[model samples]
Target chain A: MKKLQLIASMMLGLAAAGSVSADAGKDTYTKVCAVCHAGGIAAAPRYGNAADWGPRIAKGVPTLYQSALKGTPKGMPAKGGNLTLPDASVKAAVDYMVAAAGGAKAAAEPKADAKKEAKAEPKKEAKPEPKKEAAKEAAKEEAPKAAAAPAPAAVAAAPLVQEGASAADVNSFNRLLKPAGKRNLPPPEDGIHDPANDGTHALQPPLAAFGSLPKSFAGNRVNWVEAIGSGKIKPRWDRTDLTAEPIVMDMNVVREVKGSMPDVVYPHKQHTQWLDCSNCHPAIFTPQKGANQISMASILLGEKCGVCHGKVAFPVSECRLCHSKKKDLVKPATAAAR
Target chain B: MRKLLTGLRGGLFVGLVLALAAVLFVDIQDAQAEYGDVVINNHSDAATMRPVIFPHWFHRVRFACKVCHADLGFKFKAGGNDINMVKIIDGQFCGACHNGEVAWSVENCNLCHSAKPGTPTQVHESTIQKLAQPSGASQKK
Candidate 1:
């Protein structure tokens, strides 16, 4: 008897946790949806405004679902750019939103009408003209059913699998997720964002450019990159130059100079964007290095670094760029010769 | 008929001799030359010849190969460029860099292999300057 009571209480707790709408949803609405919907930009219905929602709610839950899912001229982003939320969750959010706007009567009226329609459907088989009405209602019910199930399954599977996979694999998986091999829409296309739903929009990865460079300048600095990663780079109030943090990158060029030897943790990316790919590929480094003989002797003879650095790109004349730690190795004669 | 056979045999012999000369000429012309002042008998061989001689001054100005070679394709190894010379000529091996827009026109031979010493090489300084400049919202382009 005690075990049965414990099981009943656990089930109740789980149900409460599932249904208890978070203030995160409200916060998300303020941040993302409030942008257009609050001001009625592109005729988007206002967030807390009842007049805009009353007519929409009267059209019933499925119509509102269609407007949110398929999108409307209201300029509301598909799923409010929160692709992480399940379709059912979005519907619940819609329900919460509409109820908040004094449209509870319109929201509650749908189930009563659905019950009435359900009762009247059986009666329609006895009557001739009513069959058309029953069929149309049945089709309406089927549409939401078709749109709901697959989306939740897809949303649930996409994030966890991607959390660990390489960026290339995630891109390939995204392609596979598309229907019929058609171009898939990005997160914003579905009027949904995952972070908007769970107060964790902080975690959704931005669609960065190749090589993890931010596609936009909004997050230009390395500190901003950490900010986008999840304010986890530092405590909420702390500030530090993350790029200036000491980086000891050990790279080994395969058999060119020394196979499997540590390459100085040269501040590479800092200097890379400074030059072109041709600077290295098939050049200082061979298309294949072990195939060619690139020796330190060559670099010293004004051929590699000696060729231009005394003149350009902060010259190898400044040895500290490469040998930032081993300052003693920088010979004064070498600097004088340059 | 005897005279005709003699002429035919002579013509065949001439063709064989010419073919042999042509092969020798190609082998010498396609041989790898010493790079910089570095000498490496251990690394040098006939097979490694014509693999490619990548020019540094021409490339450093335009791109960082780390983006392409390390980020895009895996690092290369020896004997990797067992490629058709014609394909490379048409835009494959060194052709990747030799593409006219990025660096020297592949059509010019001595541009890459100029034997002259102490000739100051030109690097496109503006390209480096442009890359170093922090790109704003325009980073997408």
Candidate 2:
């Protein structure tokens, strides 16, 4: 069966090289569909796996095309997550996969005939493009109903996409700070937790629990540092050891800048509170003073202090936050005078 | 007339300085991910999903770096490992912990694939290039 599938794919590839439509199907499959379909991730039907594709094929070819184009709630992203792909390309890829699975000889036969016709008469090749464009239009009309049908009940109830807002409208960066209304949803309603999991539904909603914790302006709106300091939340220091405690160090490393900007004061107390010594040791920073050549550019690019500041910790927008210490002007001038 | 030309030039210099300052201020505002955030786009963009934003800080706080880099065979370099959904669901890379037993399973797609669409796979604000070269070599450049 595996050998047969390999021979089928090779034949498909050769046929794809002969014609534009077949070529697109194979190309789209290789580029987009293969990522999950090739491996059957999250129950996605594996290419050429008869058992996996059997039940799905029973649902019919049009249904399979819909699943491939619109995506399934099971995990498949619509158009294999590339919205830029034309509907015809997506349908061709779906046909390619269906053919490879050996479920639809009827669907595969026309493609083979098309390949032969393309070879015999190159002019006829232009004919398919119009048909494909027409298919694209038909798919566009069917898209809304197919998209609306399979939306999981939980997704519809919670509605991660705000009302009247398209998917593109949502900002993807710096997810730490959510809008006030979106902040602290229940575990299942929150996009992070799996609604299908019963355990997720049982967990406490963040809004209800975070009410007593220390408040901050950014990220989930809870000041983790202050919360830890005030003993509001005690995050485990180790994954396995229940009794393990963090070895907190209350030290500060002050790095002087060359320009007029104030010197940066790195507080070990805050960092050590959450991380172990090895996390940022020789790999990220050398222990000795003035040993590490720190710069604003490196940090901005996501190095050194940047590894965390703009990501999970407070962002670099608070310049005065890190660059807290004022430089001693008289001492430098006096040393220069000498 | 000669004095007027010098005054005009002086005014232009001040305007340029102010403009430069404004640009620098805007640049700072656009700083990338919070520290230790790795954006894995190895396939997501082409697959039509947002790039995966792996929160290094969130993971490190729970388990040491050795747990992943040392035990799990993850290289220190960003995008160094060929992580795919198949390998992850099959219990490799992120799957080792992200499996329902250790953490949340792979069902929550948007949670990790949370980056803005078109975000490339990379270590957010990667200093790896700078660290790879000697301090003197970078300074000379």
Candidate 3:
């Protein structure tokens, strides 16, 4: 199967190499980036949002060029996941996105040549310095003006940024001072049904491995819920939609085990966020409970949920990811002791 | 004040039980070092119905890791390679040895593309001979 794709890619590469044109970039952006950037999908910087694009655009077209040409650590795939595109076309699309989000100045910017882009590493680190220093100076100057401005850094950040820097660039620079602005918003909603914002009655210890997986392993469950709950990271999918437009399906399955293990509770709503209903329905798991024979052995062998868990998605090694609740087991030892 | 005290007592009890549960379960968590075999599915559904299962154990017998990885630039991570059929046919990546001269031509589709399909119901079988006897490829200097 890989061989066939290899051949097909070869053909596509040949075709793409021949038809490489400047206009292809706009077409590429429409096809690839529009989904994410247009609606702020997956926290992608919305186009024309100077605040979001400010810091990124400040990195110069070359650095942004490389991220789009290669890939971001946050799972934005190279060439927007269309691997067959020529490198020129990928860079072209990057410029197109930068311009759309960053405004006219980014569009007029010259193309980033490879050697110059590669050598531009020093500039990337230094780009944010002026903004940071300016912000500090603003704070020092403003100490006498008023008791305290809510976000003096953000307020004074306009003069720090170059005139042409887009809103995104300013937003990126101001994002640094955002921690100081945390208190500005109204207190988070509090209720037993809703997760608590403050650590008032926090139960779990500091989740060390909440941000990223330490190492890849089978059965390693990357608990999205725990990760989101701990406030270390947010789910890429639209989590807020769950509140207003809820889609709930409570699937409880009790498997016959030799000893004691909690029954599997498959919540349909969580999976629906990232995947379509058809991805798993009649094809992967039968609709009828007690119909399919699911076991740990089959999962390890790459059947059922194993299809996504360890491969493209997180691993299943973390047992608690599934058996979220504790169960009362009938123990013969306790009865015998009595 | 009494209500507040009751709530505090409940919270403490829950926290203690959860902490104890964490300690008991920490030992049982999977700390095994070795990784399972990788199932390459990039192009499985592209041509034939099945994906290729490349067993590292099978290749570890034949060649030094450096030969295919360092020299040839085969990425150690799975799904890292840009391996398309044209490059392979031109003697790159798997094609380095998979050419008929070195091993077998890729003409026989069933030769290596033999793993279970992503579809749930598809039954699969592996013909890649697992040598019960010691492998001869390991002796290659």
Candidate 4:
């Protein structure tokens, strides 16, 4: 009876130890590594693919750990771009992946105590199967639902799972519409700059300079137009020639829409303030009225006016902002008939 | 006979108004992308990765079109340029700036491959269906 009790206690201790490391590895992988590894992105070894793991495993476990720790030139960011993760946790995640790919023997050297634990709980290896299936299902179902919903404008708005790894949707692509907390981080802290570089740490934070700028509701919450007009910011018009002046065309092109929405009055004055005429002419737009087939669909797809509006400028969400010109309701019937 | 024509006109007006409302609602729902962002799927789908969403405006504001279009050898058409990892790490195309010197290196995969899963390589699907519909409001012109 005493021997049985001692053996039972030992089994429980081993199981707990094994589960702790396994859970930690899974958590880290799900939050960080899964973004690329799960999909084999950029040729990242897919999770649970023994065939993919065979060649990599032959290279030895230390090499795998080194690759994960330092990152590869083929596009694996060091520590999977989550620099906060401890080295031990990353190594454990690697072990977890290696064990799953039928390379359990290779991963046994580093964690000898967990060897028996891992073999005892072989069922734990199969658990990721269900999760992978669910992720694939979710990916599959999301496509059709996104298509059925109108407007592809929000298509690119899909959350980048890497940045925060939280519930809050981080729009990493658009610098203008970052979440409130993420806005105006210091140069080094901001993902744009290399944190290791001393120059980045010395640079002025954007929030400090942006304080005096005129405020707007959208896109970094600064009214750039108002700032430029008020002479608060004078952007150099040319790169090489200091005296080069922008040919600011004040022309407004009004596009007539058939629906109840107001006609789109595209102001060249605002556009020409920043861009050269050659930027749009001949390439994006033909520079003739009725010659260009400017549709809302094409524009939403990142064409014509969309080349600027939904990207660097204000997003398309502000409807009244663009569809400003009121239709002449009194003179409509004659034009419609013709 | 006169009343029937008047009634027909009234019915048509109501239908047009409803159609217009539907179209506007769709536009509002769909228009969610930051302007000047291009989604590049060219090979990502086959590679089992999310499509790359290139923020054109972010670069455009800092540099002129000629810098990339002429100097860097990037083609004018979307998805026209054959951008691969080999060329990038070898110091060509995006790698010229993204090589841990000018900007962030190509280490961060999700930074570029952050598009919604299954997004086609095209900038946006041309609304060929909407354009084909003869009864749509645009046809009135």
Going through the candidates in order, the fraction of native interface contacts each one reproduces equals: 0.02, 0.06, 0.00, 0.02
- lDDT tens digits by residue: candidate 4, B22-79: 4343323233333234567678778987667675534543454545654477755557
lDDT per residue (tens digit) for residues A1-338 in model 4 = 53344344444443443465677778888989999999899899999999888888865554576567546656777678665576656766876788789886554322233223332221221212121222232222122222222222221222221111222233433323333433344444433233444443544455455678887666545566776668766655643344666678899989898889999898888777766667778889998998998877776655777665554566566778889999887776688887
Alpha carbon lDDT at A87, candidate 3: 57
Report the number of the highest-DockQ candidate.
2
Q: Candidate 2: what lDDT?
A: 0.57
In model 4, state the lDDT of residue B59. 58
Instruction: Please provide, for model 1 over A1-338, each residue's C-alpha lDDT reduced to its tens digit, 9 standing for 90 to 100.
Output: 53344334434443342355435446556755677777888787777788888788776555565455434443555566654455544544665677577765665444334322433221211111111222233233232222222223322322322232223223433211212111122222211111122221222222221124322221111222233335222211101222322222334332312333334333444433333445455556555534555444554443555443322334333344444333334477778867
The ten-residue window of minimal lDDT in model 2 chain A covers A120-129
Q: Which candidate has the highest TM-score of all?
A: 2
Whole-model Cα lDDT of every candidate shown, in order: 0.36, 0.57, 0.43, 0.55
Off by over 4 Å in 1: A1-19, A22-28, A69-74, A85-89, A116-338, B1-141
lDDT of 3 by residue, B1-141 (tens): 345435533543343244334332321221111122344556655665455445332343233333565446665345558677799899898887788865667885544554434411111111010111111111111
Candidate by candidate, in order, the iRMS in Å equals 29.9, 20.8, 24.4, 18.7
Best model number under lDDT: 2
Residue A150 Cα positional deviation in candidate 4, in Å, after optimal superposition: 50
Output per-candidate TM-scores for chain A, rounded to 2 decimals.
0.33, 0.43, 0.33, 0.45
lDDT (tens digit, per residue) of candidate 1 on B21-128:
433333222212111111111122233421122322223223333433443342332223344446547766556445675445566643333222221112212122
Q: CAPRI band of model 3? A: incorrect
Alpha-carbon DockQ of candidate 2: 0.04
Better of 1 and 2 by DockQ: 2
